[model samples]
Target: MTIMPNNPPIFSTRKIDLFVPEREELASVLQNGLRYHFVEATVEWVDCPDLTQEPFNLATSGLCGDAVISEISGMSYLFPFMESEFQYSIKRIIKEIYNNFNNGLIIGASICLRLQQQYLVQLGELIMNASFSRITEDDIEIINKSHLAFLDETTGRCALESITNSDPHCYPHGNFFISEGKPGQVLKVRAKKRIGLQFLTALQYSLEKKYSSGIYPKLIGLGGTFVMKSGRARHHIMPYNWDNNLTNARSIHNWLHYCDLDAPLVAVGTLLSSNLVYKDACKFSDLEVCGLTETHFHTFSSNGAAGGHFYTDLESMDPVEYLGYFYPARIFNHVDPRPSCNELIDFTDVMRLATI
Candidate 1:
């Protein structure tokens, strides 16, 4: 593998005339004020830097329920595992992730199905009855009380068993899980209802208060994008709503960082979005980019799967020209249903062919 250079080119953008047809008013409002960049370069993975190294521990945090479902889908495609077998596999993966992270805390959040029916009442009940306190080995009663009925009996048992064996202290709020571990020093698993950064901030504050020390927590959002700005700014890029916010050089810097990782940990769902854009004249001069194709781009944009608007800021480094972005085609295992356009391929094949 060729080592990426320390200094890479900056990504640049240009104006494009693409807009969501249904939300034309909204798109017009966005297009009128913003300069859109139509990314023309093929996004390849070789040109980016590798971030899966020391001092940069990556962890996946998002909706565990969705994760569980995705796992089931993936497994079902590859193996002939029955319900019971699948449950066992799920438990094994959960345990494997917990152990892989060195017995660190794992946190998650979700709204209760029962509570969803009675929004006001449930909200009040949750506020009054919920306890956000840290759980320890002795806090069995509290853990059981706070547990929500989101998971099946088998899955819940598996998750609880994994936590109990690894960390001993845990707090389950609705669909969220917060296990006990050292602040920033140890690997931590955190999940919430789309407010992961906010939760992390709160957890940091709590840790500081409890331990009275500095903590540098390494976090990665699963099924989502976590971008670190040029300075100290941090933002979460969701799958939709790209045009709702202003994305400048700092934002692009963070996005490129995700693709630059050694393994390109950015989720496949995010890459499919139209929000990620570049200009026709922009040059990916420095970084090696990966993923997607002209056909995939057309499908994503025409099918309304992609949202958001892109704009150019001369002050920020142009990613296409400097850092470059990677948007590899989605990969599927042997069992995954093939896309009509044949866009999906195995990463191993990509690596072998691309010589990464």
Candidate 2:
């Protein structure tokens, strides 16, 4: 509940050793650099002062279709943005990531899903605070086209440039990893491919009794993660953009201003840096901090920062039902016939269940 501050040495890293004995000589893979330090044992909520402040908004993009930025597996970038992107697509990314080692350098960073979902978080906040009634259908239409898909001509690099230009100090690119996680070093990232339509179920149910379909944004991704760098730190906090040259939201960029009463919706340097491992870490999830499962739960209770964020609100619903699907044990074992996040909640039933 307390406001966390931002300090120098912006992003930190952790020196970890991963031992996945899936193959004979491939027994060890190390250096998961990011390590997070939680304010409280139960990280119920979080705020990024540095990210929301001036010159720190550079990292608020998801790079929607660039799989090569960090040498991300084709599965990671493909499934999430492939229109009909699979939910557990990150698994494909991780599986390939396991083989990409050979004295190679992974410029790790977190890339959130496309832009439409970002708009949902923003619009959801507005409606969550009863601010939707103030906007007209035209505004709704504007938000609809914000997904920033990288079609033929649109360039994802432009978005990356915007972030790099904004955050010059302590940028986590160089291997000068930060040590412990705090507000800035810790971020919320989603592992599942998302359309973010389900979120509207709750938002509409909670309010919008008299609103129309205009309140709804086009379907897109909604997942993000929390990266804690030690060595594992800044790898996952890179600026992600759903925007490309043509689909740019230059007209309506979503900046996270600290002075605004609304929650911080974007970050760059302030995001927690994290890395993945083939050992004891939670398999396939982007938010894993330490490779040890015991410490992972001890650190992060959930992805994102606070209880008010869109993903947080979604996970908080029906704890028993939600947690049963999201717990660590099940996450590691993908062969258990588990489905993706899209199937978790029935959007229609949820919206229909909304009580005016």
Best by lDDT: 1
Where's the lowest-lDDT run of ten residues in candidate 1?
293-302
Clashes of 1: 32
What TM-score does candidate 2 reach?
A: 0.19
* lDDT, candidate 1, 1-356, per-residue tens: 11112211221111122111122232232222222122221211122222122222212212122111011112121111112221111122223322222232222221121223354211000100111222342222221212221212233210111111221221111111222222211111222122111222322233222222224221111121222121111111111111212223333233211111111111111111111121111123332222211111000011211211111112222221211111111111111111111222212122222222
> Model 2, which residues run further than 4 Å from truth?
1-51, 57-356
Each prediction's total of clashing residue pairs, residues at least 3 apart in sequence or on different chains, is 32, 62
How do all models score by TM-score? 0.19, 0.19
